[model samples]
Target: CSNKSGNKILYLHFDSLIIFHSITTISKVSVTAGKSVSIPCLYDSRYMNYVKYLCEGYYWNYCNYVVKTNKPDRSGKYSISDDKNQKIFTVTINQLTNKNTDYWCVVEINGGSDHGESFQLSVSSGKNSGGMKWCRLGRNCVTKSSGSIDGTTVTIHTTELNVFTVTMSGLKPEDSGWYWYIQIPVHLTVTEKLINSKYCKRS
Candidate 1:
């Protein structure tokens, strides 16, 4: 089961009468193409001395290493720093592109199971004049022209500065997951109401 508290997410798993808790700082992030973003990963105090790293992939077991606290990338595309006093580590990715999709903040365990939390990254060109589409992952996208989908209504408005604001109405509890704005994948949590929305840019 998963529970969200503020910007942190707690995931629980049970195996062999043991319980595991995985907490993540953020679930999703979006950046303009060619831009950079810094993601923060918070961990338990017990992992303060452990190795922390950022890996990229949709699956945890097969994610490719992007950067680590001990091994920083020489190419300068990625870097990680751990703040032992704060129990948090931050990963910075530069010159992001659309290909940067899923990633994980992982805490390494020497002789036991590792702990991790996954987050999705979305990149947009900000040069598409055709406006944008709001989509649920694996489902059809809803455009301003289309107006609605599956009992939900999505309205998009563009400003003179090319900034796009998307409003989603009639959200249910099941709508609480990943959604995309123009190619930007963002996580939205719906409880008594919609909790998050993204302001997209298109030129």
Candidate 2:
């Protein structure tokens, strides 16, 4: 988590009560297909039984498990879990598709209350895409003199976002290479378009 101007950017999870003693922000995330991603959350207690806290909510939906109706809506796609004593709730999803779906995690606190957060799932619509690509200001993809490259490797601990903004400058002929990446285990969606030539120049 990074702090800018005394504001802490943290990802909220679906494990705890809706109301909190302190103001906590849930950082958005992107995930890929056929992988398990952890939806981030926080709580004020040391106990990890957040599934109990969810009982306060009016609705609880999980992988083929609906608390209210006992009937499956969409089977085998979601589930809930705990992580040590961190009060973090882990939501596991499997067999991702290209369907632009929005997942909702609703909760309640102070007895008979409710609140929610949502995450988006996006699939790659084009071929030959870049992963978390970096770009500079006023530069083409092949021009090394115009932009800088962050390369293809992603350091998970470096940035606290499922969404990354890529920017570069002075992209010269030598600057042609694969610049970005999207990790499936992290639930990420990447958007890429051609800035110059179809192929990167290796001057």
Candidate 3:
């Protein structure tokens, strides 16, 4: 097992069969609706000559290519650039909207396995940003304008400039993982609270 650029890899073996699974860190990026955001993707030096591209979709295998180092998007909504010397590529998404969801940074390989890292994108309305939704990846979402989910409450008012908060009451160990507020994604971890035995009274 190893961690690379926020991606966690694990290997499972069943007899002679081996399975590889990866869990990527879903970063939260707050961008106003109709605004633009640039994301940087870093790859191994061995893939310097490989084709770098940006793909959009909730699933890795089904993601559609948005932009590539060789084929720049002509729609002007997406752009990509690569820096071979630094082993990094940058992709810019312009005029973002709620429709923009999950994305993957990928390196193409011929006759071999391709490498990719996935991230989630969240879009916030510049006006009336009070309404927000909380969601787990590939699952249903709870909206502040409607109701809460599993004791999770979202603050209907903006706490600060372009900032909102969500409180998940009675968090359990299973609640820890990737979640999103509208288009913004965050990784949450829940651990058991330890109490000092010295404070306990004998029954």
lDDT, candidate 3, equals 0.68
Candidate 3: tens digits of C-alpha lDDT, residues 69-143: 999999999999876764557778999899996888788877655677776666778643434777764346776
Can you write out model 1's per-residue Cα lDDT over 26-118, one digit (the tens) per residue?
556667789887777767898999999898998766788888888889999999998786576878889999888789888977766667877
Give stretches of model 3 more than 4 Å off.
1-26, 127-203
In Å, residue 152's CA in model 2 sits off its true spot by: 23
lDDT scores in order? 0.72, 0.37, 0.68
Best by lDDT: 1
User: What TM-score does model 2 achieve against the real structure?
Assistant: 0.37
Write candidate 2's Cα lDDT for 156-188 as tens digits. 221444444444433344343222233222222
> Which regions of candidate 2 fall more than 4 Å away from where they truly are?
1-27, 34-36, 46-74, 108-110, 125-203
- Which 10 consecutive residues of model 1 have the lowest summed lDDT? 1-10
Question: Model 1: what TM-score?
Answer: 0.54
Clashes of each: 0, 35, 3
Query: Between candidates 1 and 3, which one is better according to TM-score?
Result: 1
True-vs-predicted CA distance for residue 156, candidate 2, Å: 9.1
